[model samples]
Target: MRLWFLIPALMAAALGARDANAQQVHFDIDATLPVRDTELPYTLDLNLTAAAPTRIGVGALLDLREIQKIVPERMADNAIVDNCGLQVRLDDLSFQAQDETIGLDGGVTITIFECSRTSERDFQRGEQKRAILANMSTQATVDLRNNCAYFKLVDLTLTAPEAQREQLLEDDTLDSVKELMLAAVDLVLNETPLCPELPAELASLDPVYENGGPKEIGDGGLGVFLDGSVDVSPSTILDILTVLQQRKLIPGPP
Candidate 1:
């Protein structure tokens, strides 16, 4: 089956900023990420050569912790609004800046087995909607990079899929999906990082996905965060990158 694997965005994110990134020192870090029983953890055989990798598995764990650090002592009670409402009291994400990596170096190959929830979902007879994501438990090789870490994915293999839906492994389906994923990774790795453009408020109570409505959600995305955050964390930067993608602010790198 030819599944439309969307990378959750306005446009497929691209690799960019090569010239602006030349002078910096690079680090190549590798790791074996943790995985759920049914899911296949990726062995990030990353060859960053000279860029910092955004280990999503690592970022998710770290970011979650960071966000939790600032949960206000007495958070304000959420107010109910009309229609769809999501009340998220976000604390400023806290991370020890010292933990950041500067680059990727050395011939490294790391395996990651991330955790996943295995369950059978009953698809409605006439419905064709399916969701494929989970909170991943990732592990990595500690401190291979000297200081700053540049990231790369040399070879990554995902080992989990729906057992009953066994058609995913037919022919080049897995390779095709992996290629697309790594392309996005290389885009970020081989260049300067895509910085988030958070608002001055840092956090807010806002109406999400108000404009897109419901029907268009599947075409690209339509949930509240779909405006941007649907793909990236907090969905804020996702909005910024969407504009950039539309304007071609970040062009593709060779």
Candidate 2:
């Protein structure tokens, strides 16, 4: 199954109206999911407290290799202009999260194929591979209607190699290249869906909103928090079970 499908399935299974008179219900999930598409394992944890307003918290540790595959795709979608007649590629991507900031380290290869004044003087008609590093802080907004969360880029700082930095200082084209890198990172974080939309029946149980943005978790993972409310009636439980059954996540009555 897709990672998206598995995420909501886990959430649905964990949700319950255990106490009718209790004002709150808590859900805690800790699992390691093997993403078939990416051929990687993701560690996921979700903690939710539901009442008049539910509070949801999630922590996820992602494989950098998976992100490496996505960055190029998102970069292509941006249609970044190559005024410098340069072809760029990224590889050996690594990540670290601390103090609510994610640090990205990778190698960038720039191949100069055509003639440009700067390239003619400073660069050869070949590839120049160098280390590329960046740090970005992230924030999240909850879309309760869609039962998902959207991450936003809070701040970003790109650190280029000395040669590239010098080029950026002199050439407008290099500046565009820098912008392209930032745009690629933005697309990766903002466009990718961290949380899949839950079914309508599940979403309707509570009124949800953002409690806080994503923060640094254990090792190099990201954590997000959301707040909402729920009504744990027998009908509500039945509705949830029916949805799970319809999705074949749980067995129907024998």
Candidate 3:
């Protein structure tokens, strides 16, 4: 009887020790985004900021070189000669605990380096009309894909000084500009996975995208999915989550 009691006590102590060690484990994260192109808008010269704060800021740059490449008909009247570039920066970035999605509040800025266009007939181009936008909010969803986690940009609001804002709104390029910026940000998030490569211990966890596509945590920024959380063991998953939650990479229980 005495031996049996001692065995159970020792096992309990060992389990506790393992949990403690898991919590203390540290993971190095790299959020550097790679250059990739999307066919949607004939965007070329896609690049992300070489250096960015580990948390979030100036993650990527969007260069739209040809309006015709994005829309063939647009070329009839206008020729994009100099190309347009947009800088994406997110500040005060945080993760929401209740829902495991990241959110950016008012610290999101999109600065446009005006892309010059020439009227097809005039063959003369005006200087680029640069615009700096600030004080906007957006949210991101995280998904584990191909051995890493990817963040998807979902919501966005573009702002600038009254004069610049009006000019941007009036221009026909606003929608495409917004789309490119959001897409670039999404690519950056994918680059910055919680773990650059998923550890083998957590391999059993399968990605859960409700529509049989990629899994998502929230709604209405880049895309949406029905609600279902990734139920996982504390030892493997919690270890990484603990570190990221502290760094504001992922959310913690409220």
Q: RMSD of each candidate?
A: 23.3, 8.8, 16.9
> On residues 1-254, what C-alpha lDDT tens digit does candidate 1 reach at each position?
01121222222221222332331211111222221222211111111111112111111011212122222221222211111111112122121212222111111111122333344643222222232221111111121122122334445444434661255466444454456545654663445221222233322212122111111122221111112112223353444344344445454334
lDDT of 2 by residue, 17-127 (tens): 233233222323232322223332233333333322222223222323334345445443333323345555554544555554555555554444554355445633433
Give the number of the best model, judged by TM-score: 2
Q: How close is every model to the real structure, measured as TM-score?
A: 0.22, 0.51, 0.38
The residue pairs in collision within model 3 are 154-221, 154-222, 155-221
lDDT (C-alpha) at residue 27 in model 3: 23
Ranking by lDDT: 2, 3, 1
List residue ranges in candidate 3 displaced over 4 A.
1-99, 106-128, 196-254
Candidate 3 local lDDT, 6-120, one digit each (tens)? 2232222223333221212222222222333422321111111111111100111111123213322322233222234544555444333123444545444445564445665
Q: Which stretches of candidate 2 lie over 4 Å from their true place?
A: 1-84, 115-147, 155-168, 198-207, 231-234, 239-254
Ranked candidates (TM-score, high to low):
2, 3, 1
Task: Judge candidate 3 against the unseen true structure and give its global Cα lDDT, from 0 to 1.
Answer: 0.37
